[model samples]
Target chain A: MSHANLLSPPSSIPPKTALSLSQKAPLILAASPTSSLPWPLSLLFSRESPESWTIHENLFLSSLRTGDDKSARLTLDRMTTRFGADNERIIALRGIYEEALANTPAELEKVFQGYEKILREDPTNLSIRKRRVAILKSLGRPADAITALTVLLENSPTDVEAWAELSELYASQGLWAQAIYSLEEVLLVMPNAWSAHAQLATLYYLSTPSNITTLSLSLRYFCRSIELNDTYLRGYYGLKLVSQKLLPLLSDSTSLKRNNDEEEAGPPPKLATVKKLEELATSKLAEIVRQYNAGKTGWTGLDEAEVIAAKALLDHGGIER
Target chain B: MAQPIVQTIHRDPALFWWILLPITVVMVLTGILRHYAMILLQTAPKKQALPQIRQQRSLVRGINLRTHAKVLPPASFQARKAYMVSAYQEGKFLADPESRGKPRPNPMSDPAAMEGMMGMMKGNMAMMVPQTLIMGWINAFFSGFVIMKLPFPLTPQFKSMLQSGVGTRDLDVRWVSSLSWYFLTLFGLQPVYNFILGSNNSATQSTQQMAANPGAGLMGPEQDPDKLFLSESENLEVLEYKWVLEGIEDRLVIKFGL
Candidate 1:
């Protein structure tokens, strides 16, 4: 059982490591001549289980991500043989493969045209439509991408991934309000997404320049994000930043009065409460950095960039006004 | 005469090899064939126009909002609910604005609905035709002989059915004809199908029959999606929103000992 468990896909493998592993898969598969035997005989003679297909799929996607087009093509051929070329998932994979193979802008345009042709034949092929949007975005056409995404969302409003993508596209163009709205739409579909909440808070913070009301709203969302996922270092970091920004403003009565006059303003926290939350963020972040730097077990999951950022923030004695 | 003694007709041991084995093997093979036949016969889902897709998905979006409303704050949730309610009432997302307030087309007469019915009929036929052919084949080739005895007793009511071909008047009810053996294998080969074909195979008739009912499987092409969306919007309107993140800070404090 332990051996079987070990042979299963390693859930802890980082994406980068997984990509490299998948890139090597074709070589491994080629080395073993028996790996390509017809499925029925392989099932009877070898220890091949259903998990092999999943591994192949992962290999296909990773190969594409790493720009190993040859491995990706081989993986796609294997998948198409197994599942048939007409299979919906296989068709989507083929589209992704073509997208990966397109090197030049003209090639990308060809892929985009191919997607449009498929979409005309079957309007419900949302995957193909999404690829088309990605091609447009890559082609330096944000306006066209926005229009395509909007049309897609109008048809499939509950697609959280599309909503998140639309939010990013909006954010890239400095359309903060539209980005925030799209992110809220994503939250509507998946409410407990703490990462999304933190993302939304970041958008809110970026939209305004030291506005007390926006900062207070950002602080609440950050708190909500950390509340949902207690170990979200980014959420904690946002909370510390917002609380610090709000602390100075809360102490000044004129700024507090100005915040109260704003319509739709989130309720500002008390000065003592903000101070306590800031202290909590500081201590938690310090502990995380110390443990992670010590190479302690269970703390290695913290992103290195985030820890460095937190360390730098602590060293700076918080963001100077 | 007093009550007659129950007479047992002993069947040949070769009956197991010839009659029982052939029937069981044929039943299993036919089941495997039927599963593949159904797979081959399945039609790909047809695409809908943009407006139609929008109309259906808008309703689903409303339902999702209602169900997952706890994930959003009160203000955001209220804003969404208000927008959805008004949109639904206004028929803003209707696929064909001209069809608004008109009577729904009859599911039987509609060509798309006819296609849906045909698909169901095909599935049922795939399940039924082979079964009848195999049963007839068994009756023709392997009849008028007692094949096996049941391990358990059956009441006299089953005597007529289980001993269909064999006509010995006073034979024990447990002494069943080859037809009964065919019936047993027909019902009992489900586990074998599961072993060979994997679970969720179309070879299993009971599950397939249950799924063949109009409302059981994926939304068939026959049903009016507009009506579905309208009803879903009504459901959404009555939902009471409660924010799950309310007092989340306290829970976090308790969890992390902050």
Candidate 2:
């Protein structure tokens, strides 16, 4: 059978409409009889009605230290058929569906059917797309997963979580340029995102085959990342990385002056920022050195800048030998 | 005596050079010049008998992390690049699958067809082959790329969620202490498999294996398939909180060979 048809089973699953989070608010409010149960748990176990079967399933789920496939299957069927088409029951049952699929051999695609039913109802749901992507990846359909993520992004570019997941997928696949590009998109949406900068720097440093221009841009992003979050260790380390290239430049007056000229040509604020960084690196090397000494582990690839800065401090006799 | 059928009516040397020489050259280049022209003409792209799986949310999330987004949200440039690559990759992945799946007739089968196909294909192939190779190479290279770049340099803002604390309690530090070597060893396995198995054949094999033995890639050896199915349907909270993580780990290893 065609995979699409397999997913869209002939079973009498109700067509989904809008899922009403507001309608379910009251159900979520009711507490379980046991005072010891957490509020989240209470919300799940308070009732046995079809309206609350989703919650009941969750309650039953929490108690099973090991997996309970039969109960899970029963809950999924009840949630799928009895609950309203536009209910979050399918969504709620997703966890159980995944577990059952993993543990049970026979119901692999049946689990897929539930997921498809959800998507068919709410195609734009980012969460649904995220779920679908996971299944695809697990099934070794990275390419298909990539497609779903792209579709999600097109609809919802601001979905930061989706973007992050997509980046990891690319990284796993060794698509550095694509990975680097995705990280940049994350920064575009959330400018203060320092880790994205740090990761971009890493991609350029490790993956891109020896392009000085890309390397320099990577350093520039790291510097900006540092400015955004001073405590960001990755940014400082990235600086050290570029410093390896900058070392020769720092010694060459021609390059130094050229850099100065380039800085001068740019916006004044950026140039001032560069001067500030130079001062910080010169003075703050001591604290970094102290931290390094205080810490047991020596360094990581991200720590190369601090290492360089410490070497400079030691060379200048800033710290007691 | 029968007259030799040497009709000189169509003796246009210019036309021969213009059409036949280039065609001959292309056919030789593609190495499929031996097949009959009629067969080549009749060939068409075969539809994939493989299952058409819409991206499930977990799979999407995994792909996002593995390929595009190494670092999670609230990170810095890593996030942006992750987004960009994802958008780009998705766009590529969503392109007409039929066109992608269509098998081009073996241009190398007939010298004329080979030459013609090569001439036309070379342009597209030149542009596409490197892009594809690079894409695959990037996927393999990224595991190390992410570790080298971010390596939990700071308590990434998201760190509070993954694991928290200021000085000694960094998750990356702990993860490094525990999993760094493991990651390093694990990281190369996929690329090595990809190198040996080749992405096209290996990816298909893995998927088939997963479908055949849904539990094969799962982490534990003594898993009861019946229990797994029952648990998945009956109890969701445990599935979400506990089994899902385990499931992802097992599936990733099987899928990526990580």
Candidate 3:
């Protein structure tokens, strides 16, 4: 399948409709378990496709999510029977089930203890280790969670999910520099992730107290993000916001003078160039809002709240300029 | 002894349509059938319990760490290596903690090992049974007949095997019986099978042999990944670390001239 098709449902099928269909899947399967068994089970027996496993796994997760613990347990049992109880994925699922069952902090603590015991026996269980980190974070132990996640990252540097989680944890702790570093690690693993680029720009923007250098760095990162994904609403929004903040700094020579002794936060773009880029961002944001507001087919994917916010910015920038 | 002049025998054209073509078609069909049969016979992979999975994947994780260590900085790699080596030595990731330090059970006795062997046996059987049956069918019906002449020459040693049904001692080895035609189709129809059933079809004997061979080790359940991990840990411990990103900035400046 083409990557675009894989990412988005066919244009004929709306995303919300597809989501509702998936949501209704567990209900249908729960209603007719026997009929569901024949097709996937027969496919399993025929060995025509291994995709049946993924279908079953999704069914299990959905069942768990919908509070149909009985069906969830059944699907889990079926998966364990097919794959074996020791399969890595099944173990992860079992951990998730335990997490779902733990209503009280005490019960969560018990689950935490269970994970620790399992980790003691098998220190390399990265999934369980991740779960332990999550439990620690939930239990208000950010330090322990950070340490655990760092160790996990050391072993599996390519784990994008863990890196993203660690970044969030660091961000929550107001460790801006560490959060930026962790997000950079995420970028290193998945350099083309435009979302991460925008996120890192946001982080950089938030880190310093309205410094010209930091604003410029944030602007460049936002531009890089928009360069990777042209249609990214958040990237364009960030670009406009950062540039608006930057334009005044560029015009004022005194604000820039304070940071002259420090290392240049990259080669600072010239004042005229910064002004031009800010205008470009404003124009792009206006175009996005206009297109999205007109109910254009392709622009339907743009967030309504963002479009409204952009419109407000355009109106606000009109008076300021 | 005096050498005699070569004598050419007139062969019937009817043999091509009557025997060779029929046998070729049958062999191809059997191959397609065997491919589907093998697909039907294949069992889904048995799932391992969480601890077993942990034990297997933890070792895998260590091996991955060792292999991809260059991706990490020196400090991180050192920390991971130290942890993995110590954990491996202590049997921290053993599926059953009580079973550690005890000698491994004979693979023959292990149920999982037996299942692997059974899968191999099934593949071998799938390839062999149809072959033996076809050979017998050809031999019973089409014996004592010279069907066609090969376009190449063979030594006198082949005469006993290839020309088995034909009692004529003076016939060239190239002028073989229908049974030899069966053997030719058996070995030579691999490409035909590939075309008919796709490349990874289990119908081909050569592939089955490759799977059965311990050196190829492509098929069958793997030997315990825990043991594999332990050995990998030893390898990682001994490996000389050379940090690839040691002077990354300098290299970048040299490349990009920024």
Best by lDDT: 1
> Which candidate do you rate higher for TM-score, 1 or 2?
1
Please tell me how candidate 3 rates in CAPRI terms.
incorrect
- Candidate 3, A48-139: lDDT as tens digits: 23555566566566555656677667777777866788777788889888888788999999999988888787676788998999889888
Q: lDDT of all the models against the reference? A: 0.78, 0.44, 0.71
Most DockQ-accurate candidate? 1
**Residue A180, candidate 3: how far off, in angstroms?**
1.6
Candidate DockQ scores, in order: 0.44, 0.01, 0.08
Sliding window of 10 residues with minimal summed lDDT for model 3 chain A:
A1-10
Where in model 2 is the C-alpha error above 4 Å?
A: A1-86, A89-101, A104-110, A207-209, A245-321, B1-258
Q: Which runs in model 3 stand beyond 4 Å of their true positions?
A: A1-22, A26-48, A66-70, A258-265, A315-321, B1-258
Q: Which tens-of-lDDT digit does each residue in A158-181 have in candidate 1?
A: 899899999999999999988988
Second chain alone, TM-score for each candidate? 0.85, 0.17, 0.85
Q: State residue A299's C-alpha deviation in candidate 2, in Å.
A: 17
Ordering by DockQ:
1, 3, 2
Tens digits of per-residue lDDT, candidate 3, B1-258, equal 877555576878888899989999998889888877887887865645556655655665665666656544445467668987988877877767786556667878889879877988888888888888988898888987788877887899988778877898788788878887788788888888888666887788678666554532312234554566578778988987664433332332233233
Off by over 4 Å in 1: A1-15, A27-54, A80-95, A258-266, A317-321, B1-9, B152-174, B213-229, B232-238
TM-score against truth, every candidate: 0.85, 0.35, 0.62
